[model samples]
Target: MESKIILITGATNGIGKAAAKELAKQGHTVIVHGRNKDKTLRVLEEIKAETGNANIDILLGDLFLLSDVKKMADDVKKKYQKLDVLINNAGGTMGKVREATDEGFEKTIVLNLLSPFLLTQSLLPLLSNAPSARIINVSSEMHKFGGKPFFHDFQLEKNYDSVRAYGLSKLYLIWISRHLSAELKPKNITVNTVHPGVSNTNFGLDADRGFFTNLVGKLLMRFSLTAEQGAASLIYLASSDDVEHVTGLYYGPKKKPAEPSDRYYSIENENRVWGYCSQIVAPYMDT
Candidate 1:
């Protein structure tokens, strides 16, 4: 495989960082993305030292802002002519209450779904230009258990809960991925989503659950995959020649199919979610 240009969001920690390290080890040019400058720099230095791969570059932007997402896409496009892989690996859950961005959209939705949607949209031309490109969305199992988000209350304006909202965002991501799979079929770009499995990331920053979360982490996640293990499927999809032309599919622990909640299997839902995403990011979409 030729040296591929890869963009991975939320690379400071967890699955994102793990994917970055592994991908770099494989000799791919990795664009490491993070919101925090200090953390990104530290991780970048470590990656370079560990992998001896200097091709890694850092892209920083607050994903909650569509303008930042657009600017980040522009920044990435400027640095690389061809984008062979786009991994939407950033995610977070807003605890307990509803939160909105400066633009009045829900925080979780903006970060997890809208940012990826717009970033992928803006980078389409570059990705399509590559002979073989892939878009890997990092999704979660919560989406299967999480309830459907209403079309009318798309942003959860009337009602809200942090975990539920996060799941809905993942659902939208899966939906969007499937739709892009169909739309980009004729292009060189491929799109698919992945489940990283219950990871021990710092996403659970809430100190209130320190006791229980720690216990759960020790019991359940300790034996489970580390960030590197969780990121295996993503690295496979990104650099492995095995999945050439693979697109619009959902993967679980071992690239196996995890029956998505019935709703996610519907093309109707995918179309509707895509419509909603386009409507949400219309103002900031790159022309």
Candidate 2:
């Protein structure tokens, strides 16, 4: 297999880090994205030493802020001409109390949905530069519990719960991935989402999501898959030849194509989500 240039957001920890290390082991040019400079550098060196592959790099950006997301994309464009695989893996559940970023968008929405949308749009040219590129958005099974959609309440101004916010963000992410897959079909840029299952990672363990929820989360961690186990689907999607032509499909942790919940799906809703994301990131699109 031809080695590819891969970028993975949230590569500092958990499944993202696991995937990065594995990819680096395969001799791919891996760009590890993280918010913390110290942590990102440490992970970059760790991957290099562990995999014995020095083709690893790092990019720093806070996905919660659109400005940072745009700047990160710019940084990538400056460094590499073509990106073969982009894994939008940086996402987490916020605190129980809804918090907004400095840019005034909800934290969960910005990190999980808007940031990936903007980053993908900004990197389209680089992705197109590759003979064929892949876009993997790390969604979750929680999307099924997103409840009903309030088209006008994307920011969750009307109603907000930490889990709901996360679920909705992942759900919307899947919708946008589908929309983008179709739009980029002619460009040979395949797009897909993945449910990494319940992974034993620092994903939501630190979130202030009340007492019982936190307890349950901790208990789940004891029985959950390891980070490496959870990242199997991601590595497969990023490197396997079987899915080279597969686009717009959701993969489960089992490393096979699976059905995403369509309880709240519709063509209209998908288009609406796409339009909303495009509008939110329009200002950063050209910059």
Candidate 3:
């Protein structure tokens, strides 16, 4: 396989880190995104030493803030002319208490959905420059059980639970992925989402989602997949030839196509979500 330039968010730890190392081992130029500069550089060095591939780089940005996301995208455009694969792998659950960023948007939605949407839009030019680009979004199976689409209340201003917020964000991410796949097909960019399975990462462990929820999360971790195991599907989507032309499909940990729940799906709702995200990130689009 030919070399490609790949950027993965939240690559400082967990599944993102695992995926970055594997991709670098495959001789790709891997750009790892992280919020903490020190930790990110440390992980970059670790991956280089372990993979014996020095083509790895790092970019820093907070995914919870759209302005930061835009700046990060600008940094990428300034440094690299083309991007082959972009993995939107940076996302997490919040605490039980509902919180908003300094930009005044809900935390979960911004991190998991809106920021990735904006970042992808901002980097479209770079992605289009590649021969055949891929956009891999890391969604979750929780979208099936935990998502409760209150279309009128996307930000969950009224009823907000951490798990529900995460589920809705992942669900909406799938919707936008499908929407973008069609929009970017002519540009040679294939967009898809994946469920990494229940990984034994620090995913929901730090979140204070109340005593009961936390306990259940811990119990489930005992039987969860390893970070590398969880990242298998992501690695496949990023580099495999089997899915080179596949777009707008959801893949499971088995590295095969899987159906995403469409219980709350409709053309109207999908368009609404897209429009809502575009409006929220409009100010950052040009800058």
Candidate 2 is scored at a TM of: 0.99
For residues 203-249, what per-residue lDDT tens digits would candidate 3 score against the true structure? 98778999999999999989999999999999999999988999999
The lDDT of each candidate is 0.84, 0.95, 0.94
Instruction: Tell me how candidate 2 scores on lDDT.
Output: 0.95
Error of 2 at 8 (Å): 0.2
What is the clash count for each candidate, in the order shown? Answer: 0, 0, 0
Query: How do the residues 1-287 of candidate 1 rate in per-residue lDDT, one tens digit apiece?
Result: 67898889999998889999989998999989999999899999999999999998999999989999999988878877888999999988776668799988898889889999999999988998899889999888889655866778878988676667878988888888888898988986788899988776666565233465446645776566778778888888898887888888888866665666766457677788888899878888765
- TM-scores, all models, native as reference: 0.93, 0.99, 0.98
Error of 3 at 36 (Å): 0.4
Better of 1 and 3 by TM-score: 3
Model 1 residue 10 CA deviation (Å) reads 0.6
Q: For each candidate in turn, give its C-alpha RMSD to the true structure in angstroms.
A: 2.1, 0.7, 0.9
> Cα deviation of 109 in candidate 2 (Å)?
0.5
Error of 3 at 67 (Å): 0.9
Find the candidate with the highest lDDT and give its number.
2
